[model samples]
Target: MLPVVNNLTLKNYSHLANSDEVSFDVVIPSLPGFGFSSPTPKNWTIDDTARVFNTLMQEVLGYDTYAVHGSDWGAFIGWSLYNSYPKSVRATHMALFPELPLQPEQLEAENITLSKEDAFSEQLWVDNSVGGSAYAVQQRTKPNTIGLALYDNPVGQLAWIAEKYISWSDPRRGTGPSVLNDHEILRVVSLYYLTQSFISAAYIYNQNPSSFAIPLSKAKTDAPFLFSNFKYDTFFIPEQIIRPLTNLVYYKSWDFGGHFCGLDNPPALVQGLREIKKYWHY
Candidate 1:
């Protein structure tokens, strides 16, 4: 079973969705403020999101033990879920792991390929930090100001997110606007629009009140994990960072594709899921 943003539905794992090969039921619930689920009364944090999911799993789903797989924002949710109920979650697979301090070897590796452009790009975020922090400055600090402006205006939102999706996927590459298919990107974003979570989603920037906010911690999960990296991704995490964190069940380094592998390269995404199912059965 999987929890998903409202509006965007989960199609069963391609080949295995309806096949007799895998009998386990796959459930994808709409998250609060995104789909059928109700919007949260207050700005929600990753911890708060995890708590709701835990309740849904234990009380509604009636599952005492299960596996978890998360990608994008879902990756953080899965981590929080695993931490909150270690005994219940048997294994977890996160496609994008969170930020973490570089090991000595990692720093050495990062230093080896510091091209002029890379250095300039790295320097831009050096002061504020990477990924979430930069995003927080915009979303947490000035949400309403931005949200009021973007609401109902779809084109603005599309371009705003599209650039990041394209840039972060691999800005260096001459990839067009987005790697993911147009439809999939809209499907994911529509959840926010339909549920009026646009402001709420932005609000998550401010309410980062939880242990999960940190990059590294002693709070570890016994569940195994897997990561698939497309070499062109804007944010490349060295194997060194991932290998130490979990039971790395699988790692595939593809020569092509970007951050949105599922959209950019559907066949590859399908194959990846197939491989995971095989591993799950094995």
Candidate 2:
């Protein structure tokens, strides 16, 4: 993965590790302010994260070109990376579309009705102070306070992150049963707790520009992209939101899985990747 803003680690990528067909070396770096990575000198936004990731890929990793995959914040960074360095990204895929909205007409044409799930997501956007991120509300409005609380309390960190993971996953997709194994969820959760990366990961929300207003960064991405739709993610991107973006050749809708599809539905996740690979040479 590019850098994990969340508490997740390379070890959590066991799904990829066990795949015999995919022979890929993984590089899991902690984003600045997360894990072992040093904190940024000052507050950083998504753009800053993208710039730092670009440098990591080009100068630090000496990677001229590479394929990238992202979930949650990772997906945001991946899109930004592709936007910032199109030539450097061979191919990119994301499990969920961010909070970017579509034109009113587009939303209407799709007949996209906001279901109860969508309403929940909308509330998150509406309630957000600067824009739409519960984490951002906490971070931007009160960073030091929240950070200090979670700094040493391991339980606080787990609860904060676990809630996100649970909420981000689609509740309709049998979140409590069929979709993701509790052991699997706990594995990733434990990783976060052990690392004490909760506050740092949550800080990503605070640092990034609020989602109430979409950033101009969307225009920066021109590389091949995939938007894997899950039943219940933190935000719902009706097909209309995605239709306008050019260079998006692959769009797959999963009957199962949620925001964290890579973990909740690995088989489906792998299938999505395989389909993308059919066209994307990487």
Candidate 3:
């Protein structure tokens, strides 16, 4: 999901532009309690947001069906949308699928072998779980603590969000200078500071603590699924594991880009979505 400070239209993925055969009317909405949207009631989760968005497309916008694409939190909500309203959401595309890797014991029991890429991805996951994910833990358990701390301090907020933007992006773009300029970063930070919505945005982690939990059933959605694995992303799930989880129609791995594909490599991100259009059924 785009952060609270980031609106849906902020990133320009030019590859989503209309073509003779395909055209897209993108509807970019802020998550509840984020950006200009009102705060969610206590205990709201991704599922709740999905329901609201479904209504927006079906009832409000007067569409009988729709398709969805998401990264990060948006991916979680996309899963919920596909699961909860199978008939309404026709297809799904995602940059990040929040599924844990097979445990070492499970891999051993299955006699699974890892490729060079898979091994690297596995190591990154292990490293992040050990320390790189401290921010997630804090947001999950004590959102208000950090929220209150960074709420009014723009510098503090910048440092908090900017770090992720830098670390989670392609090394080429994230290092030395960022793909996003200081002005852009400031704009995002200012949105949270002026609106004081960072608190509720951070609360999403607390509300959905089970987000990281591995699915009990690997087969989660029957809807067609498309996934793009960017090299520098936090972790990359092997196709062997992903194949069982959904009707994975297309999967591609890039040598560049990272967690923030929309910013780091907008064309590639948009191209991935365009590829999904081939499998999308009305």
Candidate 4:
């Protein structure tokens, strides 16, 4: 599930009229080399994470099948579970598209016309590709260099994560100027710094070179794929382009929210995730 402010699983999913806890149990693992999780081999990637999570759900947790939800890299992980283990994953709801997102220039070259909304979405994708991918490259190419550089420097690490949170999130909010404020960004930075996971977390980009390039033919699955596209998230592959990627059973687009839709728009994220429950069989 996408991480909410304070692990609001039952609250967002909502429990019984009187009960405080949500009916179903919530399982949120710290991905390998993330948060409090242990270190991982240098070869570990999103697929590795997915396989491990599959085992966790089936072997350790003893769940026959479960609903899946994620955003950003979490989107890639969610898709991997559905693609690799269809029978084990009942359904998936994602806030971002997993495949290599289509570029505006690519669409233009193909003579494809997009609506105004789609146009803006593609533009944001292009802008992010230009300005926002530096951290990805830095982490992917030489994680240790930066990781150690900022290992003892909490302030530096804060800037690293805070920059993305500021630039990527939808600045529009009903209650505030930005979806994520100083406190929210600091929470993640503090976790990374205190846990001393700065370097380990960066290894994901290094390990997952094929995160976005996976071909649609290889992504087939029996379980339904539910997509929730938020405007500011920089993933805006059109529906026609997305339909061929998997068993895309459901798709919803929002005018607001950002990469962290759970934080940017909690209610919408909950609604999108809850949709998969209807498709669940076990």
Best by lDDT: 4
* Ten-residue stretch with the least lDDT total in model 1: 1-10
User: Per-residue error at 135 for model 2, in Å?
Assistant: 4.3
Please report the TM-score between candidate 2 and the true structure: 0.74
- For candidate 4, what's the RMSD? 3.2
Top candidate when judged by TM-score against the true structure: 4
Q: Which residue pairs collide in model 3, if any?
A: 1-73, 1-74
CA lDDT of each prediction against the hidden true structure: 0.58, 0.62, 0.77, 0.78
**lDDT tens digits by residue: candidate 1, 1-282:** 111221123345575466644444455666555556665667577778888787888789898777666666676777787666777776665555655434335566755444444344334334324543555577767878877788777776776566666654534333433335556557666755666667666665566534334665533666556676664554445555577666667766665556565555444444444454544521
Question: Runs in model 3 with CA error above 4 Å?
Answer: 1-21, 103-110, 174-178, 181-183, 214-221
List candidate 4 segments past 4 Å from native: 1-22, 109-111, 173-179
Error of 2 at 256 (Å): 1.2
Model 4: weakest 10-residue lDDT segment is 1-10
The TM-score of candidate 4 is 0.89
Write the candidate numbers in order of decreasing TM-score: 4, 3, 2, 1
Instruction: Name the weakest run of 10 consecutive residues (lDDT summed) in model 3.
Output: 1-10
Steric collisions counted per model = 2, 0, 2, 0
Could you tell which candidate, 1 or 2, scores higher by lDDT?
2
Which residue pairs come into collision in candidate 2?
none
lDDT tens readout by residue for model 3, 1-282: 232213233344464345323556678898887888888999999989999999999999998888888888998898888777888888888888866656656666867777776676666666766768889999999999999998888889889998887776676873332345456567778888888889989989999999878473554457788888877787667777777778889988876777777766666676677776687777
